[model samples]
Target: MPLTARHPARGLLDATQDDLGCGWAWDQVHNVTPRADLSCTYCQHRMHAKRSVAGLRYFAHDPGGPQCSLGLETMEHRLLKLQLATAIRGAGHQADLEVRGPEGRWRADVLATTGSGRRMAWEAQMSSITADDARRRTATLAADCVVVCWVFVEGHRPWMPYVPAIRVRPPADRADPWRVITGLFRWTGLHWEPVQVLLDDFVAWTLNEQVVPRRFSPPRDYWVGGWTAPQYLAQAARRRL
Candidate 1:
């Protein structure tokens, strides 16, 4: 299920918004009767508005439709995309969900674009992926000038230290927000250490170009990031950029 759908006359419609950008009340599409004219943004199939027990709003594919690529994504993956997109917009950047590369070379879970034209793909890789496969996919996006960072919500990932990725603690309840558990690091002159930050703050800083990835030396294969602000970098005097 997704939070966005297409309305023939109103353009793109967002279930998460109280105001559909066109001054239409969110209820115009949500209610006991709900609108029947909505369609999927990806497959152009008919869609229906739905609200989860948790009160989250989204659009679900109508029954018996061709399997849409977006419809195939897991619930966790879709929620994470919602989180990433909201954060990117909160940071004053643009976030496009389920973005496809030219000729379908690659599909990004969430494609974030900065005001300066730089783009980054945030991939929520909750499912298992071989280290080599992850590297290959990351390389594919990079070849298209789109950098990627894999994200894992569970803690048992063996590829954690081998890819450009981060571990986030997913919300346990509606009141909890995602907390960045790792993936962002700071060089302490002698070694690197993880930095604790709220997901929203980290996403914002990253989109603003204040945080950056630091690739490890020849012996290591993974990449992590640190803030570029003077205070954060002052401790890494001995580490070369």
Candidate 2:
């Protein structure tokens, strides 16, 4: 199942042994020696820990468990959802993880309300999702008076007919890289920082304009163009340098 926690108090990404989110340090858990809280996050069914012969440990539901579709969530998918939810809450917004939409037809990974009282649903897509499914979920949330935002994790690129998407990357040992002069960070240190780019600006610079095409062409094409909001911000930063 997507990385789930027995108790998601703080965002699941930062969950300790007591919560048991994902590939955590087993040693830490052993040291605590606390009673296990094995409950399925999706269906609330009784779960048990499965430690493979190869030393891989994970949570699994017992026999005759409820068929929760979200049980197919990967560890990466869970982490991304938790990380985005934490970021949203840290920014002074009220956020809830795994919130069900109106009539329970759909669920949002991170449902947040800004200080201005604007409600938005942030979905972290680490696994494959069909275009039709995406639109249906977005529409469901929209009908409930909530805006939908999609966050594509690393290795999962957004396809055509984009609906507000922000790509987030996992951390690496190498130097941090920016996305085409944009402040949007693939990963810095160990945190995933995603910058907000106006959809219109992104479409103009990334699709509509021939000046900034699919790939960076010629000498420093990205450095010259200020069509996108990120480009404008980068240009302004350069002047200060």
Candidate 3:
């Protein structure tokens, strides 16, 4: 998907670069890398290396540096939001990707406007989450638009509120299922590897029989285990710098 031309411009010190669309320029002073050549007019932080992922470019920064304030995880989350925006637009929707709300305050990860002028918002939760924050943002969605949460499970298919979640598994009839079985065992620290099952079957099992206990709990306890959207947002809210 390609980026929409609806990007809202703001007060930004644009840097001179050949690939303007493939690289990012921030106030150089906010960058933290020792070799950064740019200086930021707004803060003491210095710019780091230029990183490109999935064809989009971004300026990397280290907030843990002496003068830096934002955490590295926070920066990564922002990048993830950008990547998700790109993905959403590639799906053929007139997506604004990321944009400031009418108040010029809140920025949505992905704001898509359909041909019929319907608007929708999507927040990709690859990190931690807070229930309160989620509830608040969820409420702010446009009256005619739907707010959808797409939780990517890293190596697994994404989990959505309306869609059933299922784990990927190898075919049972394979002659050497052990190799694939062992991979799943190592991938997800589970007592037993997942067997191929229909999405409906998995949903039924998750809601009905407690064949497998809830793999994910809530808050802090869940973060230590593995990456989950709810856990990521919860942690993101508590950062100081």
RMSD of each: 3.3, 11.1, 14.5
Which consecutive 10 residues in model 3 have the weakest lDDT in total? 177-186
lDDT of 3 at 36: 41
* TM-score of model number 3: 0.39
Score residue 102 of candidate 3 by CA lDDT.
65
Mark the regions of model 3 whose C-alpha exceeds 4 Å error after superposition. Answer: 1-49, 52-56, 61-83, 143-146, 154-241
User: Residue-wise lDDT of candidate 2 within 1-241, one digit each (tens)?
Assistant: 5334454432242231333435555444332546355566568776555544534444556678778766666666765665565556545566666776656777887777876676777676666777666767766787888866566654544341434455555445224321322223222334334444533333223322222212123553222112224444444445546
> Candidate 1: where are CA atoms >4 Å away?
20-24, 31-34, 218-241
Candidate 2 vs candidate 3: the TM-score winner is: 2
Residues 122-234 of candidate 3: C-alpha lDDT, one tens digit per residue = 45454555554544555565333553333333354222222212222332452422111111111233232334433223222222222222233344222121212333333
| Candidate with better lDDT, 1 vs 2 | 1
In candidate 2, stretches whose alpha carbon ends up further than 4 angstroms from where it belongs are 2-38, 48-64, 155-160, 173-241
Query: Top model by TM-score, which number?
Result: 1
lDDT of each: 0.76, 0.51, 0.36
RMSD of 2: 11.1
lDDT, ranked from best to worst: 1, 2, 3
Candidate 1, pairs of clashing residues: none
